[model samples]
Target: MFQKILIANRGEIALRVLRACKELGIQTVVVHSTADADAMHVRLADESVCIGPPPSRDSYLNIHQIVAACEITGADAVHPGYGFLSENAKFADILAAHNITFIGPSGDHIRIMGDKIEAKRTAKRLGIPVVPGSDGAVTEEKEAKRIASEIGYPVIIKASAGGGGRGMKVAHTEADLEVALQTARSEAGAAFGDDAVYIEKYLQKPRHIEVQVFGDGFGRGVHFGERDCSLQRRHQKVWEEANSPALNAEERSRIGSICATAIADLGYSGAGTIEFLYENGEFYFIEMNTRLQVEHPVTEAITGIDLVHEQIRVASGGGLSVKQEDIKFNGHAIECRINAEDPRTFTPSPGTITHFHTPGGLGIRVDSGVYSGYRIPPYYDSLIGKLIVHGRNRVECMMRLRRALDEFVVDGIKTTLPLFRDLVGNADIANGDYDIHWLEKYLAKEE
Candidate 1:
């Protein structure tokens, strides 16, 4: 086991990793930016290091500074708690070169899965079903049109190197394809520095389902069911739940098994998520995140498994603690991302949180890094915390979430609390009759 682990990130996730390390009796050295000197993770860690200034490029994303922290702290391993360098292959390689373990998948897997084009091709080669469209990037308009024609109308253009909905455009008809292609390419170029886009058949009202897979790095793995992250706005997931309301027992079993088998076959290690788009009883591979996801808390709530601990143990050359058959999915779990944004306009709201009172009681879990007086730096993501709840079933879970959301408070800055408050009473939400665009459409109607 790793006696000392350096956490190479900040905010709630960094705190999340810190708690996990404490549970395993491991010492943690949290690396933070100047903006996060008073952050909870930094304050609670066994030791702390200020990597650099507030800007991500010089701090959270600084490879050399992070490596230097590891060297100075004598950390045996580094755990990137999602975002930042979690999926960065070069960072993983650098850690390996320093003889320090990266508590995630091998760099090779990260590189392969990080590229959208290569990942799609790899998924198809692995016998996993993929969306019908061009086999590779369509650099030419003619090629894109041809693929659109063959795949029928209502095609979507996606960046070959994009994620988080950037560089993505949907065309409802042939006439819209040209504009969508151009828009997708331009956005892709600006966001990912790669204008290369691919065409695929777009499913109307698709549900975003992702399987959580964990590998012990020795050809053994397990799948801890799935999460319904379909509740998104502008391609960013806002609310997530484990044991999707859309899937039946058989569907869940089939997809989860396939995801687990693929992880074992590919020799993947640590924690990873295989995301899919489901429509009309069919699942098409979207992509694979080669590190822990932000919504991992929902899976942990339902499965009673500590994913961070698993990742750390596997990276330390330990086998998995549980098998597929030994695992049991207990209840439905839901996670709501509470960001410092306007509930109505969704504009960024960053400042000092003068007052903050998290909800308590049964089935309520709040993972946050800020306190009542903490200043939310404007230089980073607007997310301030996550509220996760678990119940014996979805009904209980929804009700518990409603109560918890009502009790929670974060004053002195606008938050999306009003939005979630609105959702709690919506009938569609109660029935779980929503797709990826459901929240967007709801917001449009409200506007």
Candidate 2:
């Protein structure tokens, strides 16, 4: 086991990792930007270092500074709590070269899965179902048009190295393909510094379901069911739930087993999510997140597994603690990503939190890194917390979620709490009748 681990990110996830490390008797070092001088994670961490200024490029994303922090603290491992350098293959390699362990998959695995195009090829080779689209990246306009036409119009152009809805454009017909391709390529080049793009047959209405899989890097793996993240806005998931209301028991088991088997074969280590688009009794592979997902709490809530604890264990060369059969699904769980933003306009709301309150009681958990009088720095993501609720069933879960949302309060700044309150009361959300496009349309109508 590592004597000390450096948390390489900030906000709620850093706090989450810190608590897990404490449980395992591991000392922690948290590095923060100047903007986060008073951040909760820094305040609670065993040791803290100021990396740089507010800008992410100068602070959180600075590899040299992070390495220096590790060297200075004598930390043995780094647990990048998603975002920033979490998926950076070069970062992993650098850590290994310095005799520091990265608490995730190997650098080679991160490189292979980080690229969207290669991930699709790998998924298909592993017998995972994929959407019908181009065999590889289409460089020329002619080739792009040919693939789009062959895929039967309504194709989506995506960056080979992109995520979070960036560098993605959808074309409903051939006439729209040209503009979409150019725009997508331009956005791709600007965001990822790679103009390479691929095409996929766009689904009209598909549920965003992802299977959570963990491996021990030694030919052993297990799955903890799936999470339905269909409620999204601008390709960002707003609400997520475990045991997708859309899937039956058989379908869930089939997908879970497939993902687990594939990870076991690949000898992947730590936590990863195989995301898919589900439509009409079919699952199509989209991408795989090589790091812990933002919505991982819902899966943990259902499986009763401390994922962070497991991540640390596996990264330390310990085999998986639980076998496949040892895993058992409990009830329904839902997570609401409470961002510091305007619920209606979707604008960033970064300011001092005057009054803060979190809901309590059974089946309710709030993972946050802020308190009253904490200043939400504008340089980072606006997500202030996650509100998770679990119950014996979906109906009860929704009821509890509604009550929890009502009790969650953060003053002196706007938040998406109002949006969640509206969603919980909606008939479509209540009955679980929603898809990837549901939230966008709902927001449009409300506007």
Candidate 3:
């Protein structure tokens, strides 16, 4: 086991990794920007270092400063918690060159899976089910039109290396495809520095599901079932639940086995997620997140597994402690991403939190990085905390989540709490009859 590990990010996830390290008897070193010098993670870590200013490019995303901090703190490993350089392949290679372990997939694996187009090809070659689309990058508009025609209408043009709902455009017809192709290519180039875009069949109202997989470097891998992330807004997940109500036992088993085999075939190591889009009782591969996901707590709630600890064990040359049969899903779990935003206008509200109150008791867990006086900076993501709840079933889970959301209070700034309150109380959500577009339509009705 590593004696010390450096956390290369901040916010709620940073604190999460710190707690995991403490339980494993590993000292933690947290690196923060100038604005986060007094953040919760910094206060809880055994050591803290200031990397740079508030700008992410000079701070959280600065690879050199983070590596220097790891060296100064004598951390044997670096754990990137979800964002920033967590999925950057170059950063992983740099750490490897410095003889420091990266608590995620290898540099090669990250590079391979980071590119959406390449990942699709890899999955197809491995016999994993993938959505019908362009075979490779569509460099010319003429080629894009050809591919779009072959795939039929209602296709999506996506950047080869895009995420977070950016660099994507949906075309419903031939005319829309031609115009969307040009605009998508330009946007992809500007956003991801890659002008390459690919076409894929767009499944309307699909249920967003993902399977979490963990692999030891020695070629052993296992899955932790699936998370129903169907509740989304603008292609971004809002609420995630484990033991998806939409998947049957046979379907779950098939997807889980396919995901594990795909990861093992790729020689993937550490923690990763294979995302899928399910519609009309058919599943299609979307993309794989090469690092821990924001909604991972929901999976942990049902599996009784510490994913962070598992990542550490894998990086330390330890095999998986649990097999496929050992994994058992018990109860339903839900996670709501609490962000600093107005529920009505959906605009960011960054300010000081005058009074903060978190819900507690059985079946409720809150992962947060701010205290009563912490001011939310507008320079980064709006997410402030995660509210996770578990119950014996989906009905009970929904009720518990609603109760928890009502109790969660953060004054001096508007939060998404009201949004969640309205979400959990909806009849569709309560009945587990919702698709990706359900939230948008629901919000539209409120307007």
Candidate 4:
């Protein structure tokens, strides 16, 4: 087992990894920017290193500096908790070269799935259902239209390396395809430095479902279950739930088995998620997150599996602890991302948290990295914490989430608390009538 691990990210996830390491008897070294020197993860870790200034490019995203921190701490492995360099293939290679274990999948797996287009092809090869779209990247305008024509109208153009809802555009007709192609290409180049773009049949009102998976590098793993992350805004997930209200026993089991098969075929390791877009009882592959997902809490809530602990065990060369039949699903779970932003406009709000209080009761869990006097840095993502609740079923989960939201409080800084307060009382949301576009449209109508 790894004696010490360097957590290579910031905010709540960094703290999340630290706590998991503590339980496993592994010491942790947290890397942070100047703005996060006083962050919760740094405060609790056995060792902390100041990598650079507040800017991510110079700090969290600086590969060499983080690698240097790991070396200085004599860390045997590195745990990238979700963002920053979690899915970065180059980062994984660098760690491997330094004889340090990267607590995720192999670099080859990351490289193959990092490119969204290649992942689609891989999924198809593994007998996973993928959306009908271009066979490869559509480079020219002529080729773009040809694929779009074949796929049907309202096709979506996406960057082969895109994520977080960027580098994607929808074209309802041929005329719109021309403009969308150029814009998507430009956005793709700017965001991922890859102008490569692909096409997919855009589904109207599809539910975003993803399965939580773990592998031991020997083609052995199990799918804990699936999470419903359809509650999104601007391509970002805001609310998530496990044991989606959409799928029943048979449907759930089928999807879970298929996902586990795909992961094993790829020989991937550690924790990952296979995301899909479900419409009319059919699931079309969207993408696979080669690292832990932001909404992983909901899955953990229902399955009682410590995904991070599982990740560590695999990275330590230990085989999977649970087999296919060993896994079992439990009650429903829900998670709400509490970002330090404007509740209505969703503008970034970063400043000193004058007062803070987390809700506590049966089935309530708050994963946070800030304290009452903590100053939220403006240089990174606005997400400050998460509010998760589980119950006997979805109905009770929603009821508990509403009650928890009422008790939760954060002062001296704007948060998405008010927005969640509104959502908790929303009847459509309560009944699980919302889709991927529901939140955006709901916000638009309110505006």
lDDT of 2 by residue, 401-434 (tens): 9999999989999999999999999999999999
Error of 1 at 346 (Å): 0.9
Ranking by lDDT: 2, 1, 4, 3
Which stretches in model 3 have alpha-carbon errors above 4 Å? Answer: none
lDDT of 4 at 162: 92
- Candidates' RMSD to native: 0.9, 0.7, 0.9, 0.9
Write candidate 3's Cα lDDT for 1-447 as tens digits.
999999999999999999999999999999999889889999999999999999999999999999999989899999999989999999999999999999999999898889998999999987779999998898887888888888888999999998877889999998898789888888989999997889999998889999999888677778999999998888889999998999999999999999898788777889999999999888999999999999999999999999998998888888777888999998999999999999888799999999999999889999999989999988999999999999998888888888898899999999999888887878888888999888888888999
lDDT of 4 at 208: 94
After TM-score superposition, the amount by which residue 112's alpha carbon in candidate 2 deviates from its true location, in angstroms, is 0.9
For model 4, the superposed segments whose C-alpha errors exceed 4 Å read none
Model 3 gets an lDDT of 0.91
2-113 per-residue lDDT for model 4 (tens digits) = 9999999999999999999999999999999998888989999999999999999999999999999998989999999998999999999999999999999989999888
Clashing residue pairs, backbone N/CA/C < 3 A, model 4: none
Residue by residue across 93-165, what tens digits does model 1's lDDT show? Answer: 9999999999999999999998888899888887678999888888877778888999898899999989888
lDDT of 1 at 385: 94
lDDT score of residue 262 within candidate 3? 78
